[model samples]
Structure formats: structure tokens, C-alpha cells
Target: MASDGASNNERLLAAARDDNEDLLLDVFDQPGTFDINYQDGLGNTALHYAVLHTSYDVLDHILSHEECDVDPTNKLDKATPLHLAVEKEDPEDREYFVENLLEAGANYTIRNKHGETAEDLVKPGDEVILALFRKAQADADANMDDIAYEDDDDVASEGSD
Candidate 1:
């Protein structure tokens, strides 16, 4: 069951690279196709792969699923999906994606095993990106009460004003 699950997850990730948003929706609509946060060999979820490849549609699909948390940390790196996106994307993109992730309930202030917060990964004083980062941070801090992911894999977030 475990390896089958793993192989299925690998397929899901490949679909993400192909930018097939429907694949995840299909999985979610099925009886029990995914563990939602399941990781493959390198501690990456379908979420991570989607972001790595900049599959915007797939990213949207995963974020829309109630069974997936926006802040799920990879087991080996203890890095959230947001963290991986920050590391992999360019600065402007990192800011926008991080804001979406935070508003979706990622704890933006949290660091990984490398002691690097998403904020730290960004270069200092890159104005356009910095503004968005600050906006995201402020939004995250203010909405702490409004953003939450339940232990049972439920995701609910604040209405952005």
C-alpha cells in the first residue's frame, strides 16, 4: 500500500509538471487517491513540484483543496511549501507567491532546519519585492486570528481586505 501510494504520488507530481490542474481535482474528488501532503523520495509533495515548475494552475488546484494545508513542511528539510517557492522563484515572484501562501495560512515567520525564514531568503532592499514582502508580513500578522489549518487537514483563511 505504501509503495503504491508513493508511485501514485509520483504520477501526481509529474502531472503537476505538465501543468495538469485537473489531475489533483480528480484525485480529490475520488474516494481516497491521495494523502494530500504525501512526500516522495526527496521530501517534496505535489505542491512542491507544482511550485518548482511554476505550474500556476496546479498550484491553484492544490491550494483550493480543503484536504491540503498551505504550510505543510517537507519531512527531510522541515521546509514549508512556501519556503521552497521562496528559494526557487525569482524575487518578485517569491513575494507574490509567499503572500498567497501566507494568506492561505502559512506561518511566514517560521524558519527551516537551515535557520532561514522565507524573509531571509530574499535579498535585502529589493524595493518592489520588499514592498510585497512587507505587505504579506503585515497581512500575515494581522490575520493570525483569521488564518488556521486544523489538525485534521482542514484549511480555512481570512477574507483579504
Candidate 2:
């Protein structure tokens, strides 16, 4: 009856560009995929769409909502949001999302069953992306250092106990 407004594809595309969770929720909540490919091309639930879109709003919505599966991967590709974010173009923003996912236990080192790490997908010559990836790797490595130190400290403290 009313103008369909944007084409469904266009609407879905906008949901990514606009990066609004509330709006994306409405769009994805409908019958089919909000654009999650892991669940199947048409089956990639709303949460899956949010990651690829890199929409802060949509991402937040998905992360907070328990139903929004954070780990869905494309059947053939085996790409999780972390994998998507790693592969996606935005260096700074995508890296930020990676950090969040890692905190959530999203495996940063996970490969797509092809024996490739998230590090492999990054643009090799791109300075920004490479730098960001390097930083993340360093940070992950540092966390391990902290654990080692904590273990040493615990052993020392145990002497007093």
C-alpha cells in the first residue's frame, strides 16, 4: 500500500551503512536473514549482519542481546564475526571490534579451517591495518607476560603463607 520506501536489499544495505541497532533489529527481525551468511546466506541471523556491517549500534545490540549468536560462521567459509572483522576493510574500527570480541573469548587466533590466522587475512602492505594487527598481537602477547609474572609473584607469596 505505502511506498515500500527502500528496496529490501537497499533497506538491508542501509542497515549496514546507518549502523543503527534499533533499526537493524527491526529489519533483521523480519522473516529472513538480517544478512548473516554463516547461518546460511539467507540464514545469517541479525547478529551476524551486525558484525559485517560494523555498525556500532547494531553491534552493541547484538552483543547485548543473548539471542544474537556471537559465533555464527558461514558454513562454507567458517567465518565468524572476528574473521569478518579481520577481513573487513576498516582497520581502526574493525580492530576495535576484534578487541571486544577477544574480551568475549572470541578466538582471535582461530582460522577458517584453512590453517590461516586472522592475521593472514589482513592487507599485508597496508600500514594502518598492519599496525593495528601488530598492536593486537602484541597486546595478546603481553597478557601472557602478565600471567607469567603473576605466577612468579604467587610462588613468592606462597613462601610467606
Instruction: Give the runs in model 1 whose Cα sits over 4 Å from its true position.
Output: 1-7, 89-92, 144-161
How does model 1 score by TM-score? Answer: 0.72
lDDT of 1 by residue, 17-73 (tens): 677767656666664766767777777887777777777787777777777767767
* Shift of residue 80 alpha carbon in model 2, Å: 1.8
Candidate 2 stretches with Cα past 4 Å from truth are 1-20, 23-47, 64-72, 89-106
Model 2 over residues 1-161: C-alpha lDDT tens digits?
11267544445545655675555566667745443322435445444566676777766655654444566666666767777777667667777777666555565666776867666887767666556566767777899999999999999999989
What TM-score does candidate 2 get on C-alpha atoms? 0.59
Distance from true location, Cα of 7 in model 2, Å:
24
Please provide the root mean square deviation of candidate 1 (C-alpha atoms, Å): 8.3
Q: After superposition, how far is residue 33 of candidate 2 from its true place, in Å?
A: 19
Clashes of each: 0, 3
Question: How accurate locally, in lDDT, is each candidate?
Answer: 0.68, 0.62
